[model samples]
Target: MSTVLIVFLLYLIGMVVAGIVTARLASKSLDDFILGGKKMLTPVIALSEKGTDMSAWLLIGLPGQAFKMGIGAIWAGIGVWVGSLFNWLVIATPLRRLTGKYNALTIPDYFESRFGDSSHLLRITASILIVFFFTLYVSAQVVGAGKILAATFDINQVVGMVIGLSIILFYTMMGGFIAETWTDFFQGLIMVTALILMCIVGVISIGGLGNVFSRISAVDPKAALLSAGESGTALYLGLILGGLAIGFGYAGQPHILMRYMALRSEKEVKKAMIIAMTWTTFAVAGAIFLGFLAIPFLRGEIADPEHITLAFAAKILPGWLVGLVLAAATAAMMSTVDSQLLVTTSAITEDIYRKLINPDATQKLLVRLARIFTVVVAIIAFFLGLRAERLVYWLVLYAWGGLAASFGPPLILSLLWKGTTKYGVFAGMVVGAITIVVWYNVPILKNFLYELIPGFFLSLIATWLVSLFTAAEQRRTK
Candidate 1:
């Protein structure tokens, strides 16, 4: 075998071994399998959140946008950084405390407990949403993994996808959250290292930042503008708002929030927040710069702009290093997919099966059900990935918008507003999800603004208004 193949295989082997070892620690309980027994330390939680948050979007989608659009792409990065900072500062501690107090294992469970939903309506609705949107979300990551493997190994895309999905399912199903968290910690480190190294190499090769901008200007002067080449003021402003709205989605993402919920203590949240924010800044900056730096080296050579980072790595790095970097890119896809898989499994086994179907089920039975659901969800996502036709960025954004709109407003309100009722939370979720579906499909609406922008506000309004009306009715009846 070639040195590259050997190196890549060894990395995969290590991940499999790690999964098996962590599986031993999972115990027979659903809590240990899904939440790592709530014992994750500061670094593990911080890095796992970062790893799961970035996904292949950091490696492929963001760089592709920067390469295609210019400095305007930086707005998305800024939005995410700011959004994450706020999420950590405002949401982390309260959420950690609330989940612990209520003995909630999932986001849906938190909503159910906080609002006193004895009917299990909120839990069912939330799990359905999780299953629906997360299927598409996980599929996007699968598609990304396919792209990475195809580019690196010259394999068929479908074949590459199967290989990637198989490995992800193996580790994730074998060890659940424990395996996913440890792998995410390692993958997070690799992701940042790969991005930083790629950026440094690209900058040096192009001579400097000045040369990079000049080359972009030479190609399309307007492309170098931060305003995204829009002529009308309204259009430019809209573009900026839409890009920044990407951050709003962060507040509601269940996979990222799962990291916060898994924290050992509320006090550790502050430390994790600092580490996460610092890591995000460097990682986002590096990914964006990689795109700008690729202008001179890969202007016309590659067909798909998303492949810029991988192609750039192969051009500059040695064989073993190239394999490692490529593996890191794959790591970006796997880390996110594994986490989402585990979350989806929890929704099915804990929320749907245990809570709704068999309230008396034993811990051993729940763990077994979780494992079965993991494989089932992975298979479903793999098929969806095969059917996916959009670019990684759009696919991810579409699913991101849906989940953010559906869950973000309700989650925020539940934690911050005492008036938030079960009725209001339910309304917010339904309206948010419906708006995304309608807005995204309509050409005019989608062209004007991202689905998340409208969906988020509408959902917030629905939640608040319905909550107030219901609270007043309850007072009158009493």
Candidate 2:
């Protein structure tokens, strides 16, 4: 094979071996496997958490989106930064305290206990959604890895995906969460380093910032401006708001929040939050700069956008450096995939299988089942990855929208609103979940309706209306 592919294969093999070794060390029990025994150190937690949240979106999707949208794409990163900060500040401590108090191990478990343990149907529904949507989400990460392999080594997409998925799956299934988190920590560092190097090389290649921006402006003035050529104030604000809504997905995401729950103590969270946000800011800034700098070097060929990082690296960097950059791309996808696999497994084993199917299941048995679930989910994701035909960003966003709409409101209401009844939470979830699916399928709404707007609002309204009606009916019966 080509030298680039060999380099990538070597790096990937090392990661897989490391993951397997760590998984053997870490996966003694269900708790250790699923939640890292709730004892991840601050640095480990921070890196793994942030790295898992980023995925290929940071390395590929964001830069690509920025290339396509121009400076307007900066708003998307900013929204994520602000939203993450808010999540750490507003939800971290409370979630830790409450999850510990309730002895809840997963997001769905927390919901079931906090809302009322009368029946676990809600938790089951939530778990099903997590598995369903996350399989699609994980598929996107696999597709990203395939793209990197295809571009870097000239491997076919299908072969690349299989190789990529196998590496991630082997480590995750063997090592579980503990193995995954430590891997994420090292991968996070590599990702940051690669991006920084790319940014530096990219800027120098294009005659510096002034020349780059000037060329971009001359070619696509709309892209250079934040307004994307819109002159109206309302239009600009809407665009910004649209970008900001991305953050709203943070609070409801099981994978990231699971990291918060895994903190050794509630005390570590404040420092962890700072570290995570800072890392996010730095990585996102570097990505945007890379996209901007690429404008001059790539010219018309940058139309694909996602190819900007790889294209620039191929042109500007040497064979070895290019290998390192490709490894970073793999790292980005693996970081996110590991966390997602853990959360998906947790949703199945802890939330549904044990709680509903067998409340008295042993920890050993649960751990075994979790491993099985991890493998099964990975296989499903791989199959779906084979079918994906769109940009990684669009595929991920659709799944993200479904997840945010379905769980975001309920998670928020549970924390802030005491009047929220079990029925109300269920109503909100149904409305939110159905709204996302319907809006996605209905040609009219699918075209014009952003999932967040309708799904979020309808969920909120459903919660309020149902809670009121239930409460009033109870009062009358009394």
Candidate 3:
């Protein structure tokens, strides 16, 4: 291998070692292993949570979209940003309070307690969706890592996938939540550094932001402006709503909300929120800028928008610097993969195996089972990702939509609306899930309608309508 490739491999090895060490320290207790024992401070929780959440899609896919569509893609970030801000401000504090009050360890656990614990099936089904969809989503990240490795070192894509998976799986399986969070903290910092550097280098290489803008205008004037104004009201609203609606997915995601439940206290939530939002804003904004910055430098040679960062860096920077920049993107991908593996394992070990199949299983036994399940899920996801066609952005968006539409309405109502019934929650989940699947598949709907707009609203309406029509005793008996 070349010197640059060798250096990149060494850095990755160090990260893997760090992850294993963390897992060894934190895996003694189930809570500590999966949720960090609810003792995480503000910065660790914030950076780790948001960093894991955004992943490679932010660094690769979003920028690629921006490079292709110009300023129109900024709305994607805007929509997600607005939604996340609302989640931090309106949802995180209450979620932490209630999860703690009920001693809930997962989103499904929160649902079960908040809705009076009448039916465990709700939790089980939700857990199934999380594991099922999240595995597919995690696989996409795996695919991204493979692409990164392949592009970085001229390695085979499959070989890269195997290498990336082995490294990520080592830390994720061994360390659990502790492993994921600490690694995520480090990876998040790397991501920020790389993006900032990419932005700076890209701008300078292209003669600054003004020259960058001027070139884009010279290429496509409409694409250079904010709003793009290309698609018109329906499409714009759909994209914005689709983007912002991503925030709702957090309430349903076991991995992300695991951060909230693990936080030291409610007071920490406030501090974490500020930190998370700031990181998200800068990281995403910088990535979007990097995409635009690549336009002038790359001309038309940056054929695959997704490869803009890698191509641009390789062309402008030295080999060592290029390796570092690629490492940052790898950090983003691994940070997300670790979190997904932990949560996916949690669904099986905590929710399925321990709760349903073997309630009497010892923690030691459950830990073993969790590790087994982690490998099993990762293997399945790796295959699915290889067979899949879409890039990181599309796969991530689909998974995000599914989780949000399925759990968002039920979660919000169970917390705020006293009359939310089990029937209502179930109805919402079923309808929401069906709508998303069907809408996406149907050509007419996919062509004309945003799947989330219909699925989300209809799910909310179904949840309410079902609650109204159900027997009075069916409601949250508070």
Question: TM-score of every model?
Answer: 0.96, 0.93, 0.94
Winning model by lDDT: 1
Residue-level lDDT tens digits of model 3 in 1-478: 3656776877788778876677666666677777878876679889998877888878788888788877777878887687678777767888889999988777877777777755587888888888877888888888878878887778899888999999889887887777778778878887888888888887788787678778777877766866664567776776666555555566555567778788888888888988899999988898888887777677578668898878877877888778777878888888888888888888878877766678798777777878889899989988887776374346555677777788878777777787788878988988888888888878998777667767888889998999888747663354
**What digit string (tens of lDDT, one per residue) describes model 2 on residues 1-478?**
3566677778778777877677665557777888888878898898888898888888888888887778888888888898788889988888888888887888889888886655676797888889887877888888878877876677698898888888888888888887788889888888888889998877777677667778788778787888766778887887787788788778778898888889988899999988898888889888887777777677697668888888888889988778888888888998888888888988888887888789888877887898899999888888777655464345566787778878878777778777776678788888888888788768887655467778887888897778777766534533
As for lDDT, the candidate ahead, 2 or 3, is 2
Q: Give the clashing residue pairs of candidate 2, or none.
A: 23-175
Candidate 3: residue pairs that collide: 23-175, 38-262
Cα TM-score of candidate 1: 0.96
Candidate achieving the largest TM-score: 1
Q: What is the lDDT of residue 435 in candidate 3?
A: 87
Number of colliding residue pairs in each model: 0, 1, 2
lDDT of 1 by residue, 117-182 (tens): 888878999999999878878887787788777867889988888988888888888888999999
Give the local distance difference test score of model 2.
0.81
RMSD of each: 2.0, 2.6, 2.4
